[model samples]
Each structure stands twice: as structure tokens, then as C-alpha cells.
Target: MSHQRRRGQAAIVYPTKVYTDSRGSRVETADMDNPIPVTAVFVPQRSSRAEVAGQQDIDVTRMIVSADVQGIDSWSRVFWNGSMWDVVVPPAYHHGTRHTRHYTMDIRRRPS
Candidate 1:
């Protein structure tokens, strides 16, 4: 199937930076560069209540983007539907027949 036919929404992927703060705590900062725009297919995989105190509901989704999309990794963050989702796993590349190529990854949205 053509990627365009499967695309359901537009998303912005923000590259992130991992750094140690003065207090020696690791921090993840997003928007390291101009956000990358891509058409993607978002599949709601699972949802659960946060186990940590004072945390909001947790939503996990599977995102599929065209192979042409680049610069996305496990450290990336995606903005969609008014929320920010962290890429929980490195993108898995899929090579299909007829030159169809895509990437699939799991993303999670947690309480800030």
C-alpha cells in the first residue's frame, strides 16, 4: 500500500538531547532543531493508569512513517493531537515487496 493512503495525520518529530544537569541528573530536552514534519499512521496500542504518584494516564501508540522520513530515533519526541510522546524504541525498518519501505516504532506519552 502506498504510504499516502495509510497516512492519517500530520506529526512533528522533535529531535532531543540528553545531558547531565549541574545536579548530575540526566535530562531530555526536545526541539534540538526545527521540528520535522511528516505524515504518519498512528495506531493506539494500549493505555493504562500511571503507577507513579501524581502522574497522569499513560498512553502508548504505534507510529508508522514513510522510509523517506529521516533523523528520527529512540531519543526523538513526537507531537501529535496536542500531546508530546516519547519514542520508546528505536525505529524498526521494514522492507516490503514492490519497493514499499517504512519504519515502525512505539511511542509513549507520560505525565509531565
Candidate 2:
């Protein structure tokens, strides 16, 4: 691990399984039992109020984890700080010096 200070442990949740219906449709179900744990650093990137049909506050956060952390993609959701964050973008690999290599990704959450 790098010298970066980690905020805390974060849980990465992935769909447990995909079920095909009789009509040939696929459905994904959450895997509540298993969650991938990783040490991550969370940085609040920005917060903005989005006005659509209704006003909602959107928070964008940047999470950094070791390169060894795997199985996380845009389809994954992160549970941190008592809330769930949707992975907004694909994980970006930063191949720095051997010790500094890590993955950074942007996650978004809408305040309820």
C-alpha cells in the first residue's frame, strides 16, 4: 500500500446474479451477503444542486484505492460513510511508481 492516508474501509457491492425471465429478459439482484472490502481514501470533489422536475442535491466524490482492489466497475456501487454511492465512471488506473500505483474513480450520490 502507498503512504496515502486512508479514510476508512469501503464496501463495494456487485450484483449477485442475473436471472433470465421466461420472456428472455435479464434481471439483476443485489448481493447483500457479500461485499468486497477495501481500504480507500474518500475526497469530496464537488456538490451541486441539480434542477430537473424537482431540485436535488448531488454530491460527487473521488475514491482512491490500491491497484490490487479488483472486481469494481461502473456497474458497482460503493457503501461508505453510512450512505451508498453510485459509481459514475469506470475506474481509472494510475500506474505511478511501484508503491504509488492505485485506482481512482468518481462516485455520485443524491441526497434524499
Candidate 3:
């Protein structure tokens, strides 16, 4: 099966086309019945900072995972509710000038 790609959206996983021998008439259709839009989460920053970026997408499960900060200082995790994406946890709170920082990411799956 190859992926069906569309501009500005997620590339859907599609099954190989089926050719029938019915009077040489060819028809195309999706294998799946109800196709909900799927998207790939692209986090520009490092994994640590991706959490921040994910907070912006509409879905959470398909997030682009990676570390952002140099020493695991900050990061982001997105939450998807099948329809909306919300930052379960904002960026870790790091002191501006303090050697030690308070990093906390409250990202978790919503009881499904």
C-alpha cells in the first residue's frame, strides 16, 4: 500500500488500487468508509521544545518527538482529542538566571 499525499494536510495511508475487468471501466474509491483527516505533527524545535509546538496542533497522538534544549531543560507534549490539540503541559519553567531550573511537563493521555 502506498501513501496518498495532499497539500497542506496529512498523507493518508491508502491500499493499492484495484483494477477490475468489467467492460474496461475503471473506478477509484477509498478502501476505508469514513475517512477522518490525519496529520503529521512537525515540531521545528528540538524534542524538548516540540512540546511547545505540539500544543498548537489539532491532534496530539501523532506528534513529532525530539529533544529541544541542550541538556533536557525544556520540552513540549501535545494532547489530541480526535478533533482538537491542546498543550497538556506548557514549556518547563526555567529560571532566567538561576543555575538550577524547575522543569515540569504534565503531558499524559486523557483517560481514553
Candidate 4:
């Protein structure tokens, strides 16, 4: 995370319902409300790579935001720079400092 501030937005997505599809497969529906304005720093962790088994590339990107940001978890979806990211790891305070400065989250961008 960098000390310089960067502007961004985050949206908290909630699972609205779960039902069966036509093929008897389970499906999930999520609802996203208005975006919440945020200021933070975007950090890219290790290099992005593809997973052969799942056939999905797991690109891990970290979002470092103020401790005040709330309702962000693995279920939440983040929108940044015209792209959406899945919150793979929930927000947490690094070094056990109780998020004195900022909290971080690990996000993954799946193939469209």
C-alpha cells in the first residue's frame, strides 16, 4: 500500500436469492445498490496466473482503504475503473494494529 491517496469506489453486493435453474442446477442472485465513494490505494500482489483445472485465471489485487469502510467481505463486489472484482479475502487489519491506518482486502478478477 502506498501513502499517496487514490480515489475509488466500492459496492456492497448482497445475495438476494437462491434457486434452481432449468437444468436443476443451483443459482445465486445478487443485488448491488448505489456505489459508495471511497479513497484508497490499489496494490497488485504476485503476478496474475491461470489455473488449468478451474480454467479461471486468479488475479489477486489488494485494496487498501481506511478503517472506516464497512460491510465489505468475501460476498461483496467492488467496482473500479470500469471493472468489477470479487472479494476473495475479507477486509482485515494487517499487523494487528486494529486498522489504525488502513484495512486491506484480497480481490480476484475472473475471466469474462
For model 1, residues 9-93, the per-residue Cα lDDT tens digits are 9988887667899999998777557698887888989998868987689789999887877767777899888888999988999
Error of 1 at 43 (Å): 0.6
Off by over 4 Å in 3: 1-87, 96-98, 110-112
Q: Model 2 reaches what TM-score against the true structure?
A: 0.74
| Top-lDDT candidate index | 1
Models sorted by lDDT, best on top: 1, 2, 4, 3
**Model 2 stretches astray by more than 4 angstroms:** 5-22, 26-30, 49-53
State the lDDT at 69 in candidate 4: 63
Cα shift from native, residue 104, model 1 (Å): 0.3
Task: Work out the TM-score per prediction.
Answer: 0.74, 0.74, 0.20, 0.62
TM value for model 1 = 0.74
lDDT per residue (tens digit) for residues 5-112 in model 2? 354566555524457989999966545566877778888899987778677788999988888866677767778878888888889999988778999999898365
Off by over 4 Å in 4: 6-31, 49-54, 94-100
lDDT of 4 by residue, 34-78 (tens): 356677677888554665766556678887877766666666677
Ranking by TM-score: 2, 1, 4, 3
Q: Scored by CA lDDT, what does every candidate get?
A: 0.82, 0.75, 0.32, 0.65
Each prediction's total of clashing residue pairs, residues at least 3 apart in sequence or on different chains, is 0, 0, 13, 0
